[model samples]
Structure formats: structure tokens, C-alpha cells
Target: MKKTFVKIGLLLAVFGLLVGCDNSSSEVVPPSSTSEEVVSSSEEEVKLTEQEYQIAVNYIVRSVPLVLERGVKVPTNVERAEAENPLPTPELKYGDNLLLITAGELKYEDEINGVYLYPEYTVTYSFLEQEPYAGFTFEYDDIGRYFAVPEYPRYEAEYDNGGNPIHTVPPAKAARLYVTIHIEERFTTFNMDMILEPQAIIHDYNLADVRSVPTGSVVRVYGYFNGYFSDWNNGVLCDGDVALGLFKLQEFNHMELGKMYAVVGQFTVYNGLPQLQWIKTVSEVEPADHPTVKEPKAVVVSADDFADQLDIGNELSGPLMHKVGTTVVLNFPLRYKAMLDRDGNAVEPGALELGKHADVVLTGKDSDNFEFEVKLSLNYHMGTDNQAAFRDFFVTNADADIYFTGPLGAYNAINLAPFAFEGTLSLTPPVVS
Candidate 1:
């Protein structure tokens, strides 16, 4: 399944550049040598459940481009359907809403084989609440197999009470959705691009509707490069000290620190976060005088919530999954003085390191006083400057409000320990016990 997904991703990237090509012979494989030439008596029609039917519809919708690549006109059913609900319109944006095709609305018209099936469906580009499995299985019953297209939500938009826009895109511009489809038995796949148009472009969002826009949709955002995430090949853009979005580019080697700039790109969601990719650099501007740093959301959970922590598989599927790689404030007080050099000893705020750097354990209780624990580490050995700054901030234990700020990192299954990002540090001074 992983290999299949990789092929699908690669195929989409290639299809985006190569519009018309008959490279299907190398990519697609027939079920059997003789099956491609003739259908066997074992062929059967498999009735599909509602969910399965929807998946089949999505598979076909995603296959339109592949069919076109074969130099064949799109199926009349598909072209007609698309004509009725064309994307990139002035009302709705693709990925913003569902395109419902009731039962019998879509009929499979096999021009070559003359096979057919009527299926019901509901397809959307909205962000799914729960992450889907990395792999999927397709069911087959001879003739042609039905495959499920993996759904990856580009972004989840946040809105205001009156249904007005906030930090996301306004109602006027719709998002564009690019889809990649993979077939199982006859190992075939293709790609398609869909765009939904907004009714009107209203200047209503606080941050110019940058973060809420969809992938492949152009946007211009105003922000400053606060830091860089080398792993993802993106530069952290922030409203001030707070991370607002990511600038998707190969490197931020030439980016100036503390200077404001207007970044233009197609907004996308990567690893469950908002980002701007295919970046277009605009001119730089002066930094904001009094930009407020929007604090991370406070999450209150108990020890019981992480009781079965040693299970690495469940760790991500568990309660802390959403908090992974996100800036969050664990709203619980620390029960151990583990950040200090000596046990039970308190160090000054700016004290130097004692050479012994290790994982620090933080234990605390929720509002009900139920205990929970989290592990933190400072492994920033990239450069002396980063190491020195981290050592100075973490080595000493001073009395002040403690706030965990940075991405949540590795997890110790044996000890049920979840490691905080290397950059994780107390936002304020730690309270001396």
C-alpha cells in the first residue's frame, strides 16, 4: 500500500507537467496476460455499499484525466456531470463543499468493454476530523475492479460566529483541489485538478484569508519569517512571535530575520498545518511595531488519557495525536524539579549548563487533579548558537509561569514518554518550588 501511494503521488507530479502522453503501458498492468485480451467466465458484478459506492465514484472522478491521457474523450456521463457542476465558478470553491451525486446519478459507461454499473456518491475536499489510514484496500469482482481514492484534506477553514471570515479566505474566492487516483488489478492511475469559485471576493478576513485557502489556489500573505523547519523544507511565517503559517520552499537561506514581507503562493495543508507552496517572493516590508503573538491553545488532559502510552502505534492514534507537531500549552503544573542540575536544587534563570543534558520528565494533574506526564529534551546540536540559547533557557530553573512552547516530538514507548521538540522551552519563568 505504501508503495502504491508513492506511485500515485509520483504519477500526479508527473501528470501535472506531462499533459498528453501514452506512458500508460509502463505504468498500468493488466490483471492477467489473457485478461487484457478477453474477459473470463469468473467475472462478476459486486454490489457496493453506500461508502464503497462513494469511493468508486471518487475513483472514477479521479480517473477522468487518465482516460483523457489515452487520447479518448472523457466519458459522456463524467463530462455532462462536470458541466452541470463546473468548478472554478463564482459561487463555491472546490474542496469547500461536497458534490453529491445521488444513486443512479452516475453510470459507468465502458466504451471499450461495454460494461456498466450505476453507483451513488458523496465527495468533498473538506478536512476530515480524523486522519485516514496510510494504506487502503480495494475490492474486486472480475471485469474491472473498483478502487478507493485516498482523501487528503488540504486545509480546514476557521470561521466567525456570523459565518464571516476570520483568519481564513473570504467567501469570494474558492479553493482548487488536485486529485490523484490509483487502480489496483490493472495497475493504472491518473490525476485531475478541480477548482470551485466563490460568489464574491469580500475583504473580510483578518489575515487576508491566507491560511484558510485551499491547495493550488494562489494567495498573498503578509508575515515575517520567524524560523525555519529544515525537515519539511519550509520557513515558519508568523504574525509576530506566534506561528501563523509556513512558507513552502526549498530553503530559507536568504530570508531576513525580523523583517516583514508579502509572500505569494498557492495555499496548501501539509502534515495537518497551513502552508504556502510554489512560493513567489514579493518585496520585503518593515516589521510591525506592536504585533501581538497569539498564544497556543491550552490543552487539559489527565494521566489516564495517556495510560497506555507505551504503545507507539496508539500514541499517534490516541488523544495526543492532534497536539503532535503543533504549538500547544499543556495547562498542568510540573511535579518534578527535573530541569535542575541537582535533585531538589533550583538554579537561576540564566545559569549555564552542567554538561549533563538528559530527558526531563514533567508530571502534573488536570483540573480534577488527575496526574499526567510528558517528557522533554533539548537536542539542538545543529550549531553552537542554538545549543547555547537552549542550554541557557533550560539549564536553570527559575520561579515563573511555565508554558511548553514548540512542536511535540518523539515518544518513548517503553517508558510511555513523549519527547517535546528540541526547541520546546518554558514561555515564562518556571515557578520555584
Candidate 2:
């Protein structure tokens, strides 16, 4: 996701404040899977049954789209200093009285005393009661309103401290006085049949159109399955010159190569490459009806042309950025010079220990002498023997001209991870004194 930075200021107002109690001593009862409508009362401190508490949590979870639609609203009484500052305060706007919510590391606030607080706010809520409400908590950042697109909550499988998947109820968003309470009040009349139904609207898009939108957009696209990268734990989809990387693909193991598939997922960017992550569905296309299920051919280009496509200053604007996930046949004339370790440090050819991956330095034959020193994953699908053979062949015959073919990829710079070594040619020896 793209990082959005905003200047936040404290807003003081005269309004009834209903702070919640923090029952840390009370055991946290997990929410239930049943989608029962929770009847809320206007009276403060309304006691709830275990199932009702679970229903309330589910209501909050389902209301994320509605809350985001309402967005953050700043009070009219906020004051700003006129002094020039690096972080300028944004102008207040009239909208729904909603607080921007987030969790994990991106959260800007920390819990102090019994309340989850933001640095910009002077007011804090303390929950001191041992009630069912203690099981539900949320943190908010008003500055998040400045984001071009808000990050919506996604409830997937829960994980343990050790990063292992565990079966449990998905966590709920904290209560905002304006939004959460409003949702709670409506739940009294809300239909229980639509409790588990999805609220967000997804749109269909092609690979080219998907590239133009911001990250975090939920979209569906149709493309030919290029292949899967075992090293990266992701797949690829291609439509002509454009290709999109597929991450968190649940159906990757069962997918066939060169087949058309209708994929629904959230568009995201990892490093500098565009990808669809947290895949929702993958439906295969019938080959007999749709005869265009042929494999995507690589775009053949010289090393100079490939280098020119890179715009290091602006990753999104470059020609190469558009082809980051597509297959490419890089026809370059280079002489392998040295074997490098993971840290890009030069290592002796004999001392080079072949692990799951290795890197080699290949210098271009052109006058500019462009270096293809980016680390390549040599033994992901290929075994250590293949890595050793490539190393020995290139290192022993240092003057051999080489060619490469693989999907275009990037980290901080362009890389050909899990690339194939097509072939090599003997270079003519130059006369020496």
C-alpha cells in the first residue's frame, strides 16, 4: 500500500463524552460465528449476553465499508497557527463524524493507562468495567483521512505469535462514538439475514486498466496464467504486453499453465512491482470455447534497450515498470567476470558455496559497460547442481558471451530472479602486449 502522510492537530469541543471501561483483568471471550442481530439500548452500560456480544463484533466488522464511506470529519472550532511548517495542517471538511481506523505496525497511537490514544488528541477514554464490551477495542488516527484511499479491514485466517495459522474468530474494529454506536443502534432494527453479506462493490477490469488504479482497489480481471514463481510464492497473469503478479493465490498449486482464468483480488504493489494479493477467487476458462489460451511470448530486447526502460527516480512512470511482471528475452552480450555473495561482495570462485541461490557479475560488451550484477535466484526451481554448472561454466570460460530469458522483476532495482540461461558463444581473444 502507498504511504500517506498528514499533519494532525488537536480539536477541542463541548460535547457529551461517553468513555468506555477497560476490563483487562476480565477474560476475553471470543466472538461467535452465528450472524444474529444484536439489539442495542440507548442506556449507558447495557449488559450483553455472550452471543449478543459476538453479534455486535460482527456488526462492527461488517460496517467497515459504511464507516469508510462516512469518512473523518473535523469539527469547525479547530484553530491552526500561521507559522510556516514542513507539515502543513489540512483544512477542515464537513462530513461524517468517523475516525480513521488501523491496526498492527502502521498504527500511530499507543495505549496509555487504559485507553488507546493518538498523539494529537488530549482527550482519552478509560474502560474500567468488567463487561462484554471489554472484549472489543479499536484505535483511531484522524490523520488517516488525508489518505487518497483508506485501507479497509480484511478478516482472513488468524495467526499465532510464531506466525502459524490458527482457527479463531477474526478480530473486530474498536468503537467510535459517532460510527460504532450509530451502527449498534441500527442493529436493533437491522435484518439478521444480511448480517454476513459483503458490503463492498467490486468492479471488473483488464490488466492495462488495473495498472492505472491506486493500490488497495478490489477488482476482477481476466488473463492467461503465465506461470508461478516458487521462490516468490506467487503466480503471473498476462494480457499482451501487460502482466500482473498474483500473490496469496490459493489455487496456484492446482492451476494449469497457459490457461485463461477469471481472478478477483485486491490490487497491490510489492517493492516496485504491481500485483494482485489476497486473491478472492480463481475460475478457469474453457479452452475449447476460448481459443486464445496460448502462452504469452517474451518481448525480445537488447541490454541497452532494457537499461533505458528503467527510470530509477520514478518507478511508476518508466516503460520498464509496466513490464515488470511480464516475460522478457534479454539478448545481451556480456562476459561473466566474478562470483558474488548475497551481500554483493566478490567471492573467490573455489570458495563460492552453492546454496539455494547465488549471484554472478556479467559486464556488457558495449562501450558504456553496463553491469548486470543484480542478484538472481539460481536454484529455486533449478537444483544446486544446475547452479554449480552455471557458476563453473561462466567462471571457467569468463570470456563467453551469454543470453538470458525470464520475467522482469524489481526490488530497489531490476532483477531477473529464477531466470533461465539460454546459451553462450565464445568471444574472440584480443591481442595483449
Candidate 3:
């Protein structure tokens, strides 16, 4: 049996200011006479009055967790494993009726394959007692299910400096929304009609917290735009303690390096490192509130030590993996193998290939003479025209000591992709016998 989990949102608009109330009751009460209008003898033939609708909305609002709140703290690997194989609950078994409601501000909407697709919503909710903002995606269809569009009365939305819409709804007006869902095989199929609302609220997060969650989670983080790799179409965001890569930015052209900015995007991971992708917005933050930006110091390590850190079985768990997105100064003896281009084709001796990636393979050995291979990615974006120069020098001096400094990166095995070595690549010729 196939199981799908369908998420739905119910945005409530009340005439008066809605106050938070305690909702600890386990049972849902049927509407009373004052809240219900009976037009027929059957229980299903009754209509809900305004008062009854408000009651239902309130109950749902309290029952469903907010999206943002759930993202604050993600479950650990062990916890995730336990969740995947949980003890069955006696009360909520397969095929039992369930109501899953969530509230959030709409992020964006788009049609997939010419079919109406649901939008991802940003909301705040408490998970395991911690409140964090998270992005939630709901699934819906056009037929066989019932949904009511949420109405916002007299609210005008304006654009922020970043060109994102800002929704400012008065506290007095609210709307009632309804959705009917059916659950089978742990999946949900529902019908819905919704209008995409611009995200009004974005939560602030630190780099550490953002790195803690799984990829594809939406998050808003504030940091300094320290560096960029135009070739890779990404940049780097750094706080004092941690740095993260920013990918698929929508407004990279206007981003000024060394400026503090708040960015909202989906969390992503590449080659065991955390990154932010599909950026929704980028706004400059006031300097007064943010700390002065500082360049991250590179961790010095030997080529052999770097290789040991590249534990394929235990990614992001090793000591070096923790520093994946940061800079590193590598010191090793260069035992030249071959200089290749992006397509793994070896560059002829003394050939200069401009504006392309250079993949240099070298043999690294430890004090015990343990041998390992390391690939270094270089060229165009690294701030120099040293691709041919380095290749020429290394070809002549096959055995030399080298000090290479660049943004520490890894792929499959440990290799630097998109690294810069302006004055960072230094070589010492072998001493005469």
C-alpha cells in the first residue's frame, strides 16, 4: 500500500481580535444549537452558523502545529530512526480518520505540469517543546475534496525593499477556512482552493541552527556575505562561529560583499556540507544590530590528515567535516600525477586553458609512508591565471613541498572544487642530493 501525507492550512480571520486560549481537551465537541442550524432530519444535513464556524476554526488553529515552530529544532539521527519505526498507537491506526491542520503565511505558488500545485507555507510551531519556524508543503487536488478559500478583508499588501510582498492584515478582521481530508496508507488526498500570499513573517536564525536541520527545510538566516563563486553560482554566508554556502540566489547581482544581510531560502546539502538554496529574499540588515564581519581563519592540516577526515561512511560526523564550508590551509609534499581539465582530459605540457576548471591529481603520503590520492580543483574563479604556471612548475619539479590555501571542499573523496589560490599556492623545489 502506498502512503502519502498531505498537509493543509486553515487561515482564520476573525472580526475581533482573537486571543490565545488553552486547548488541552482530547475530544472535539459537536456544534451546539446556537452554533448549528438544522435544515433537515439527518445529522449530516445541518449547516454551521457563523458562531459554529468560528468555534471549529479556533479548534483547528489550536490543534494543528505551526510550520515555523516545527523547524526550529529537527530530530537527531537516532530520533529520526525511531520515528521511522515507531510503536503503533492504539487510538490512531491505519485507515482511522484524522485531521491534520497547520497555519502559516503562504510563500509562493506555481503550477506543475499545467496542474494547480500547492504552495509552501512558512509558520512557527512547537516540536518536542522547542519553538522554531519551518517550511511546510501541503498537497491537494482540484476534485473529490472540499476546500474553502481564506478571505482577508481590507488588507493591502506592499513590497519590501527586496521586492517581496509584505502582507499587513489588521488584527480585527479574519476569515473561516474549511478542508476535508481522507487518509489511507498513511497518505492524504484532499481538495483545496487557495491564493498564494506573500510571506509576511520570516524568522531570524543563526548559522549553527540552520546547519542543524535537514536539507530542503526553509530557513531565514542573517550573516555577512563574505565571498562568492560566480562560476558555481553561489556565495558564502558567515557568522562568527560558522559559515554556510548560499546557492541559487535570485539577487546575486546586487549583493555587496562584506555586507550583513538577512536571507530566506531552503536549506540544502551538497557533498556533506550544508547550504542555502532557492533563496526567496535578501534584505540588508542594519549595522547597529549586527556584529562587525570578520574573515574566517583557515584550519591548517596535512594532506594525509585531510584524507583521514574524508570518511565516506561517517560524513559530517568527523572533526574535519564540521569545518567543511570554511577555509583551510593545506601543507603537503606534491608528487605530481597529471593536470586535467573539467572533462578529465589531461592538459598538454605548457598549454594554457583560460576560464576553465583545472583538476590536479597528486599523491599524498603520511609520515608512515601511507599513500593516498587527492584532487585539487583550481582555475578561473580562484583569482589568478596560474593554471598553466602551476602546471609547468609542477611538471618540471615533480617532487616539491607545497602549501595550498583555499576554501576547504570535498566531493566523493576529499577534493577542492572551486578553490582560489592567488598567492596561496607556494612551492619549494627539492634539495639537491
Q: lDDT values of the candidates? A: 0.38, 0.48, 0.48
- Show model 2 residue runs off by greater than 4 Å: 1-201, 287-294, 310-321, 365-373, 419-433
Error of 1 at 229 (Å): 2.2
Q: After TM-score superposition, what is the CA distance of residue 76 in candidate 2 from its true location, in Å? A: 61
lDDT of 1: 0.38
Cα lDDT of candidate 3 equals: 0.48
Q: In model 1, which runs have C-alpha deviations exceeding 4 angstroms?
A: 1-208, 240-242, 287-332, 335-363, 373-382, 385-433
State in Å the error of residue 293, model 2. 7.0
- Top-TM-score candidate index: 3
| Tens-place lDDT digits, model 1, residues 1-433 | 1111111110111112111112245433223211112111233434554444445545555453322211333332234345656423222223222221111234565668654545432221111122221111222223332222223223334333233334443332222222222222221122223223322221222232454544455555666555454433555555522344444556446776456666655566554445566665554655453244332332443344543342453124455543333344444445433543323244443453534333445665555666655555433323445545555554454333345545444333312112223535555533323
Q: What TM value does model 1 have? A: 0.32
Position 391, candidate 1: lDDT: 50
Please, what are the lDDT tens digits per residue for candidate 3 over residues 305-394? 776765562134445644554666666665777788778898765674766777787777777787777777764766445655666666
lDDT for each residue of candidate 2 in 1-433, tens digit (9 for 90 to 100): 1112222322211111222222232322123311122233344443444444444433333322322223343221111122243222222122123233321111122245332211111112122222222111333444333121212223343333333435343332221121121122221111100001112346778787787776676678888887676666788888776678888765557777778888877777777677788787787876564455345756666666666644452143444546665776666655676777766677887787776556676665433775545445453455666677777777777766666666666556665554444432234322222
RMSD for all candidates, in order, please. Answer: 22.1, 20.8, 20.6
Which residue pairs clash within candidate 2?
Answer: 20-127, 21-127, 21-128, 22-127, 22-128, 138-174
Q: Ten consecutive residues with minimal summed lDDT in candidate 2? A: 189-198
